[model samples]
Target: MNPARRTTITSAAVLAVTGGLLTTTAAPASAATTCTSPVFKRQFFANTTFSGTPKKTDCDTTIDQNWGTSAPTSGLPSNNFGVRWSVTRDFGSGGPFSLAVSGLDGIRVYVDGVRKIDLWKNTSTTVSKTVNVTIPSGSHALRVDYVNWTGSAKVKFAYTPRTSATVDTVKPLVPTGTSVSYDAATGKAKLTWSKNKEMDLAGYRVYRRLKGTSFGSTPLTTTTGTSYTDTPPPTGETYYYEIRAYDKADNVSGGTADQGVTTVDRTGPAAPTGLSAHGDLDGMVLGWDAVSGAVGYEVFEKDAATGSYTLLKSLTGTSYLHYVGHNETLHTYVVRSLDALGNPGPYSAPVTSDGIDRTAPPAPFDLAVSTDSGDVRVNWKTPEEHTRDELDNYGRFTVYRSVGSTLGADAERLDCDYSTTLDSANDVYSFGCVDPTWAYATTYTYAVTFTDWQGNESAPSETVTVTTADGLPPAPVTGLTATPRADGVLLRWNASTDADIDHYWAARGVRQADGSFKATDPCTRSTTDPLTALCIGIPDGETAAYAVYAVDKWGNASEWTIVDATELTITPGEPIGADSGALWGGGGWTMPGQGGNVQWHCEGAVCADVTEYRVSRWNTETQTYDLLGTVAPKDGVYYQSYTDATMPLGSISYYRVVGVLSDGTETVAAHPWQIRPDLV
Candidate 1:
């Protein structure tokens, strides 16, 4: 036979396609005696579909062939023919193999006589596929096939082995060189690597990690160029980087070793705020709100606006006291915050002062003392000598308490912020500090002096002494009386007989199961304030009872003495009808912690079943009623009363009584009572 006829006969003996794109079936074939490794049997068909019979066939040594814009073989068919080639060859070992097959039209592959891949279609582009297969450990039939439908006829079939699917299976013969550089001023890192010695190298990817954190997901950047500049990160943070190379086929190589770069802290901290300057007799006192991340503060002073400010002092505190050692009168000052690296931030708004300060604060006087068993309260008013400017320049006071009447260096010292104490029970007009170490029945003397911001100390004030009370509790309250009132119940009790009793506590109980009373909170009233001796309007009914305890100066309390007032009742009516007229004036000890007493009475038939009563105290600041305490109706008593010693001080305190029924409702007072509080 001729070479063309032999080729056609060889091709016709291998494959016969009936329909579909290159669907193959076993055809007549004979064993090839001229076979070699990586060699394949080539077959050609007449139709675009791999149907009918092949026209030509031959043995091909390799699959890397480019047949130009022509038919693959000349016989009976035109340019459209679905062809396939196959050969039984040993794979040495089979784990993961990449089979690269591409051509102008279409291609497919078969392993061990089984179709393994199919890209069978008409096309002008090349296509490839990689698959992992096992062929035992030895010889297996390998097939690389293609067909030319139209256009340029080109095909390539090649492969390389890989250990696994997701790892790089190819290594370059030549190694690559890499370098890194960082700019401290800009905090930017630039990475450069030598080009990979691979013809198929596609690009390089850069990865970075913070100093102590793991490398993040995804690469920092991907580029075909050899160099890349990274976006600058936070200051003072050190970062590490690495790179990897990949081919156009997406097979990656092992990453290069990591490199590290430490970025410098080039940014300074924010400026300070709320700056204030006060001229003192000695110097100026400068203070401001603390800056968040500042290590220190820098003070700058300038004589004129045209000139730049010169650094004066560095302070670790938020405030600075500039001593007037020189006669620099017309001075302007600005403050700046400094980072740990000694970088100064933007300056504060400048403050200009006219003259030097040399005046010392006047002596603080009129120091009074209130003594308990273990503590002595030293209260003093703001000195009249404390002028407006002096108070503005006030830093703090150095308090001294000597055991005797004379002031001495061995006296105990303390520091104070404000000049008066508003929360003290005794005096709202004076600032007080407590000495918890004072002994009972002992005499103590105290003295106070004043100082300015520049440390100019005034002479000591006149000394005062106080004798502490002995540790003894007061007597129990007695002589109880109850009356029915319009709002609730009215109660009255005689003062405790004990001389040392400074206050009284009245406790009320709500009638519970089995004829027992569940006690509520105890209300307090000072005994030294005579207007609070007889409480008038309490918000309880016949179901409640009352008891009173006497408390002494040392916080000692006596046993509770119950007042049987269950028989009392109140009839709800107009406001201020009962217990409304307090004979004492409003300001003289007429407030909570220093004021009046109340008694509640309920007269309704349901009063016997009353649970508790809620008393409302007016918040002088908010002008709204706040629930002070809930008292149970006093059982078997005609009327009941309670004393309140402390609501919020520093304003007029108002009180109202409301009877609580079993249904969780109230019979409220017509209006709340009013009194002026004397304590903070």
Candidate 2:
């Protein structure tokens, strides 16, 4: 007999079916499964078919280790001998597993009484047999039989997990006796349970949810240890926890009973008390008494007029290190205490440092001065970012007039806005001041400087000398009148009284309630002269008001001479021929947002009398024509075109056109047939 015959259980042989009597398959590992072996019960037989096992009987973890050239027993025959090995193992889920056997002669394997591999023969040398077997989830039995009536006696059997599925009916034994302990201060809970006694016990999967919420599908964590700890539930929420036991084959037991635990807040420390501040050399020092339960102290510096504060530092001790060298002259600060949970308490009373600001600001830059007519204007750009004052506030600017660029002790200081509040047009913090009282034809030099709230003044900025022009604004134009015309409102006004009067400013506005006007840009300025302006008309039948302003050579404008459009109104006659049609699919009625076109003829005298044509939709519900838009109103009987891009998709509407007159009146055109537009 060959001692090395047991080596016949090679990898290839372990996978090969010994005969056609069995099929070979294996189940793959899952998220919860691992390879495991179970104890096997074995009986040695005195003969291959002698019906009696008159020898040894024992239990082994697996049938993998084999005996080659070995006797069955000390009192039994070595040849014509046989052995039977059987074992039942619990698989977690339905899946496939590999079964294999290696022996000198006659080896057979069965799973749940279904033969999977057979090599029943007398062979001169050892051979191996392997087959794939599938079993349902849960407990299943495996048996291996061997018979030796030849020179060598050997046998070995084993199994490996496969990716295939099997019928697994046995669920894992449930874990019981679950309990929880929570630490309110830490917001953590510890869960404990009796460990499962399954032979294939893998570990536990933990789950948690708020007491009233459903358990989430995924486990919070998987642990082999019998206990687990969880933290940070929504601060005041009571959480329920459960556990499930799983086997090496991924067989999961039912969930354990839910245990609840509530988390709470650890109160924060009180505010730091007895806070005081005093000057130390050029800087300041702050002191505060220790706070109970305080893990640290936070110092905050007041930096703005908004009373907002910035956290300066955290300290373990009771004093703060304040710096006066970092552009600091005066500052206010407060202190607060924080607990181990990082909750901060209310701040202590604020204290101010004892120092006066005396630092002057930088000179304003990019100074520009110009003169127009009778006025002199000064403008300049400031630093992109304003520097904080001694009291941490920004300052405003001032203008000074002088006989020369260089300022003298007797230089005249102009009245300018002195506050640093931002100007609407100062996008870059540029400052501008106007001297409208300056006399025309006179020249003056101007300079600017910035002054702080503490009265500290900046150096004089670059100076500019400006020469004003000849005179003041001309007198307002009188006798302004507007005549209604077919095309627009014709405006006329008397020339200004001032001999140096320039052109007049003209404007057109829509009429408003309370005798007011909503100005518009429909008016066209007259390039011919200032005495006349054209208030253009709209084809939409809207009346426009008119006004004129006298302007002098110095750019000074006089009060407006206004005239309402109603003073020269016109009424147009009704349109003669009107029609609507869908432009695209030809019925000339397309849905809203789809293309549709309308056309009407300017028939009879209305062709020349009408100043404009309007298209409108008669609202079915309100019985009113909603003006759609304007159409080209020409002095001809030829058809005019208008488009309706907003016609309702599935609504019926009557459309018509009305001619507009110079007097702001309308004449309705002939109504068209009712039409409905739709996409379908």
Candidate 3:
């Protein structure tokens, strides 16, 4: 179809029908229309009874002549012919008018004796046709034909005028005092149109088009209201609008000229309040009070060091969670307000805070003693301060002590007075406490320090002191040993000689490559009366060491004696031949060192370290030996017994042994006892 012609229909005759010129109440006179229609005009199509058929003398008749009859042909059957006739008094040019026709089978329309449309067919199709036709200025003839070949024939038709197009012309009738406004935040546009100019005007149709485009004929509103609102338009856009006046007959006046408007949002949202920033494991969470009428808030985060800010989030709610990533980085934040139209307001003042460090400070360093007898004094220094807070104000210090690496079951908060002023002077602090309870000649290891509000604690100040307790335990029983036994390690210690020492205390630890020892347990146990203590609960396969100390009921401890007893000595059993179907029993030593047993240590479950076997022959007068065959570590079961087969017959022979560890530790000795062929 041809692009419908864009036309402005304006006629003095139509205006005369309205009786007077019309004006818009609010807009300029140049933007109003003058044409109007009746309020009670009937809509012919809206009536359901009027089908496309010719019916006679129904409704109001516009034509004065009776519908002409169709002449019947002799050969044509009477049932093959049908006709319908109807009349409508209201008809005009420039319309979306309704024309109803009645007929059957086939039908045709004629206005003023001129064929307007042909809708006739000899089949079963409906014969009614409602055609939108242009009419000349005056009254005219209207006719319709209906035909049927073998079915019933009927007729019906009517006419009701529709609203005329109203766009791109003089201003249509708009509500008086019409105005336009905008919301910058939400990007909404409001349009207020004038009420109907004529009492008969049913309602108004609001039309809008983009800037530089033709006004669209279709109206956006069919309501009788004087105002309308367009919500959430795209940002940074301009819209043009117009209005049309529609009579009850649906005849619309020409549209008003386009009103060009560039919405400038002036109202800003309320300033965000109660801003807070909290540090979390993932990042910082920023929260604030939402501004009323604001579409949302915009968050800006700034680097504490550089004072440079970046847009962090444009959140639709009041709160925003921001992940700044690294803990070392410092951040500050601010919020900006936005209006309903999406116009952002100025940012509120910023609030700054530092992230909390939950991590504990490094262990106290350089433990030393400053006093003896009446008071035992300790001194230590902390790591460099991570925060700007003064060191002197750090919280109270707590001190802990143990007989050995294993701390005592309870930690005592030392009441000893200490001064952080030393930190300001030389980065050192001292603590002192009187310990008359300590036994003479006994030694003790002490750890001490204080932590700041940020959890940054000073390095521990440790001191080994010989107590004044009578008959102090014999040097605190030095050279304690730990050896593997069964599935765990056995801790043993040298005997002490303090006459008054009722018992000894042994402690064991797993040795870490970092030289730090993790205590198996913090509590110390008394050795079996008068005998060394053996701890057997250590986990297998872990390297362990032991320390021993002497303790008295007065809560005094002797100096710690430590030892590394990881090595073990054992005789290798005879290895059975691989073809003998005998499984090698013992694999490599279960206890590689003195501490911890090894379970399932073999590489493949069946394979074990192999070694060379030596055979020796002895003469009656002189001793002589012969070298024997060698075996690979992987050739036999780990620590099982092995027999030498290459020994000379009738000669007494003996074998000496050599074994190597995984890390190349070597042992040379006589093992697997001498064997002679005659004796075998």
For each candidate, give its TM-score against the true structure. Answer: 0.25, 0.30, 0.23
Please report, in order, the local distance difference test score of every candidate based on alpha carbons.
Answer: 0.61, 0.64, 0.48
Q: Say which prediction, candidate 1 or candidate 2, comes out ahead on lDDT.
A: 2
Q: What is the lDDT of residue 308 in candidate 3?
A: 79
Top candidate by TM-score: 2
**lDDT, candidate 1, at 189:** 85
- Winner of 1 and 2 under TM-score: 2
Ten-residue region with minimum lDDT total, candidate 1: 6-15
Better of 1 and 3 by lDDT: 1
Would you give me the overall lDDT of model 1? 0.61
For model 2, residues 1-680, the per-residue Cα lDDT tens digits are: 21211111122122123311111222211122222446666666778973753365655665654455557544457688877777777665535567777878898888898888989999978788677766676688888888888686767777875531244435666788899998654567899998664544679999998866899899999999999998845376678898998766677889988898877655677777888776432346678999876878899999758799998999888987576643445688999988767888899988886544455656888888766545567788665434333225545677888665466778887886433434446434566778745665676788888786657798989888866676555666788888665335668888777876666777787656777645665344544454766554322345557877777767877766678664222222322122332111112232222334555555555456666777776564665678877865654335565656444443433566667767777664645422222212
lDDT by residue (tens digit), candidate 1, 538-650:
33344556666668767888776665554333222333434432111121223222334444556657666567767766553565667767777678875544455443322
Candidate 3 residue-wise lDDT at 571: 20
lDDT, model 1, position 653: 38
TM-score of 3: 0.23
- For all predictions, the C-alpha RMSD in Å is 36.3, 32.9, 38.5
- Write candidate 3's Cα lDDT for 426-545 as tens digits: 644433445433444445667776575556665555545434445333456655556554323345555655455546656676666876545564222322233344343322244556
**Top lDDT: which candidate number?**
2
